[model samples]
Target: MIWSSASAGPTNTLLPAGGCTLLPRATMYAPRMLAAVAQESQQRCRFCTRARAPRSQSAGWREVRRSISSNASPAWHHTRSISTSHLPRAPLAPAEIAPSKRVIFSGIQPTGVPQLGNYLGALQNWVKLQDSQRAQDEMYLSIVGLHALTVPQKAAQLRQEKWDMLAAILAIGIHPDKTVVFFQEDMPQHLELAWILACCTSMGKLNRMTTWKGKLAALQSASESGEATITSSEASSLNLGLFSYPVLQAADILLYKATHVPVGEDQVQHLELARDLAETFNRHHATGQRYFAPPAHLITPTKRVLSLRDATQKMSKSSTDINSRILLTDEPEAIRKKLKGAVTDSERRISFDPEARRGVSNLLRICAALDESRDAHGWAELVNERGGGSGMLKSVTGDVVLAKLEGVQKEIKRIKGDKAYLEKVARDGAARARERAERTMREVREMVGF
Candidate 1:
């Protein structure tokens, strides 16, 4: 009764029994929210197209027949009903359902050595996921060097940055054996799939991306002020890559059939776009099957880490001021100096008001994120209880941050010393990634009639 694709070959096995399972009521409803929105599109939409039937035959059959009859178009009803008749009348209860293995994915751009914000915000989360992952779960963490090409870069500097990034990832506790950590540029299938997805994506969708808009606005400002490296005419053409890189990002996730993506708040939009493209591809190519599952966001606690110099802006490596951020490789003295000089309000009383007192709030957030035992508000209270002003707050926060980074800094230095081992790790990870990517591309090519 299983529907296997003859053209898909043995390696590209489609799920049996129409890929139906008794997922929890909560999990089942999550995809329905996406399906409801997708159905409005003019194109035929079959997102999360599995039928959810109950355990009782009379109730399940009635409900299954009703859903298949109502949700499907007139053209699909005959074929769908014929397929449903072969399925079991009684479905297993949610408690009886086996735990589904997860495919987790997240990537970071190889711009330079990771700063303290990167450590607390993303790298730490990556390590946490690795440590807590289920035995059957698969994890992919990539240094997205390809994504970095959207902006101008010297070849030598870019190469060095990639090396530094690889070291930083390992230093932060991303074990190669536990997680597939690879360079994005090493996998050509990423670009190959990106082109295919780009065709499925619409320009209107790309235009609405806030990150792309922000980059354009920044570029325009730089051009107006005559501070831009490229001429105004060149700037217009150069930015095309920036506008389209999100599609590549989508390819990165969908290529691996990733079910969960760890992303910051700002990157949620990109993840949504990936979901849309997954649905669109299924609608056009997979017939009635759900080929790609929409990835859910694993939003981290430390979503936004602000700059030390300017609380309004995110901590970024691109900033001209070195004091604005603390690098992972910074010595204890350097870390203490930066924390000491971090901008805060003149208020004698400490509070966690991000809007009114961004500087003080930023320091408190750092303390809370590092400690994990308390929140920003708790740290604020502790600072005030001890009658400690900004100086005491800075000193205590610096001590905690240094304590966290001390081990990571030493690990990074040790990892960076062994270039041969780093190369071997990259090669092995890329090989595994390629094996998986190739399996996907084969099915994709067959479905798309390539």
Candidate 2:
């Protein structure tokens, strides 16, 4: 959760990350605490207004306690009495809507620096969609800090990572005005709504999920490979946070009532689970109306980006080897260095057969993704016709990749330097995101009897 500078006690004083202070006991909230602090905080500091904006609501402890006891609790309890007429009409089913009318929501975890796979696979597509979408199409870009907590992290590093992720997003051309880009931690509604959906979800469905199983397998493989020091017993002790992360993921989408989610092939299962939960929720609480849209997948063409070091696996930040993935922040020289060392087969001719030649195909895909004019197949054919082998392909790929990312890298540096601008973007984006989320949540409270 995003921290606040206004500390109630020594225990409450959270370390700063990005520009904001992390709140104390931020992740843990009993119903009483939810009613007391979260509600009060949102109401008081609703927006990070411009320099000329009026005074914000007081964050004083007594004020919060008094407000909770008087207004917040009663208001919450009053949801039971909310008339059906007070609620807005639910939109048409997924099949009935056009792309323009749909709300698109997607997120990336702020766990670490995003790599080349992250840029090409997800972030780049996000910007393209935003720019091309109809004015009616609403989009949200989330720096999902909560999801990062599923794995362990140092608080200081996580905070810094959170800011760094946002900067990368902005640098890559995600405008706050065109899209809502915010920290997932800022909104308590995500967790609150997750609990409600969790009740409707089955443990069996969660068990069948491939994501947790994949994590387990990866950890087991790491243990065997000596890449990570995790033991079998340690793997067995995987926390509930990691296990039930899909529920939180579901909440991230459903909270925004997102109609479309742009995802890679690996994430298709999670998206499907989101649809199931929405259907189940509608059946139980929606009362013949589907309150949450069953989010459809807006699968991109170049979805699966493999690791530079290991073409067999998707590129990842978890790998101990830095060369496994090309980070968005890498300098041009670093990019050249990594690409020069990228693994490829001995076959002199660069071909696009992924099954027989994954490394060459991966490089071809990277070049293809960077240059929108040519598809992967077309690029592969061109490279083969040019009589250039893997060496030539790697050199060309490096140049094209470096050229594409030049502006983004520069912008990232600038954004990092301007701490105030970073804070403003986060604050403003959080304000806008919370506004939309609260609307959905109010209906949720009414339907679920609070």
Candidate 3:
């Protein structure tokens, strides 16, 4: 029998014998070659008869003896020529193989203009991920307009916000070529896959989720405070899209077969839901074949920017007061005015205490974000040594914030003015995203018996 040796594993060794060679591997098929030889060989002369024919029996006998010494098994021992073509080729060792490409997908809503919190917490890190990723890996940053539609929006203003957000993303140095920056509503596959995932999702799990509850609670608070007209009983008026958007978020991650999803602490639960849905689909449809990759969360470093007005709460777009949050596109005058009016404790000392002195702590945190070299505690110490009160604290914070946002504002203005460039970026990003999504969908359809 012909023995193909390339299929041997690294741990496998060749066993040398008087008349044959044996390969030892994890799962060796076809019993020991010697055993096969003893069972198949009718007589000792058979080995001699299969040897290369010589002019005389004396020369032929010598050839058989040489063949046996060299451990060359004859191909016609059982009246059939053994072909090595059927042997399975072994794959390369792990160290010799190329590393698999990592697919990263993350998105943000264009609910309103992105603020300082959005930049430091999410957008800035996105550019870092894109710049540091290897060529084989892909990073996607989407403008999720669909998610924004969970609530009401004016058509003209929504369109403007989408373009404005895109310009802001570009201004922050996220390369369009390296990172896919598309509008989520532009891709129909996202919704298509969302419906499929929703079918597999459990109602109990959805009920257990707290995001919807938190949103309603915020709405109720707004109503009580006269910031909104909706009453507590009007919670039922909330749209189905708002309640079930988590499933769509899952679809977004799975559609691109993303391996990593960068999210904040608040969004970790949503990423977990995405992971569960992906695993559920794979279990039901793909079985042993994992067509969907359960994505992992690349949680952003915790950097919570509190409201300028009330440091107890986070900076949010829903806040009716524009000064509560600093917008990325805010002019120097506006930034100076907002920071000047920011609340601080009555204490003469500059200190960082979230529980006791929230407003002061918020300013310190903002300063820390703008200047990474100094943390909040370090800044607090520096301000204390300088004998600065709230005025000194506000001045220092405003100067740092303005210095950092100046280039960003200029870049955003330049990018927003280029309408054709913005359109091209959106179109190109959508095409690339669609290409990746279609590939995953095709495999999913086949596995689901579509």
RMSD of each: 9.4, 17.0, 15.0
Candidate 3 local distance difference test against the native: 0.72
Residue pairs whose backbone atoms clash in candidate 1: none
lDDT of 2 by residue, 147-264 (tens): 8777678999999988998898889999999999999999999999999989988898888888778777878798789877986556655889877888888899889978777766
Candidate with more favorable, higher lDDT: 1 or 3: 1
* Model 1, span 1-450: residue lDDT tens: 000000100111123354322222222332222121112222222535554433342222211111335565532221231112122222211122222777888899886688878887788888888898889989998899888887777999999989998999998899999999899999999999999999999999999999878866777788688866656555664577778988998999989988778777677778778867776777677763568755656644554679999999988887999999999888889988998889997777899999989999999998888887889999988898878689888987888888888898899899899999999999999999999999999999999999
Off by over 4 Å in 3: 1-99, 215-237
Model 3 worst lDDT window (10 residues):
1-10
Model 1, global lDDT = 0.73
Global local distance difference test of model 2: 0.71
Query: Cα deviation in Å at residue 70, candidate 2?
Result: 67
lDDT at position 75, candidate 2? 28
Candidates in descending TM-score order: 1, 3, 2
The TM-scores, one per candidate, come to 0.79, 0.74, 0.75
Worst lDDT run of 10 residues, candidate 2, spans: 2-11
How many residue pairs of model 2 clash at the backbone?
3
Best by lDDT: 1
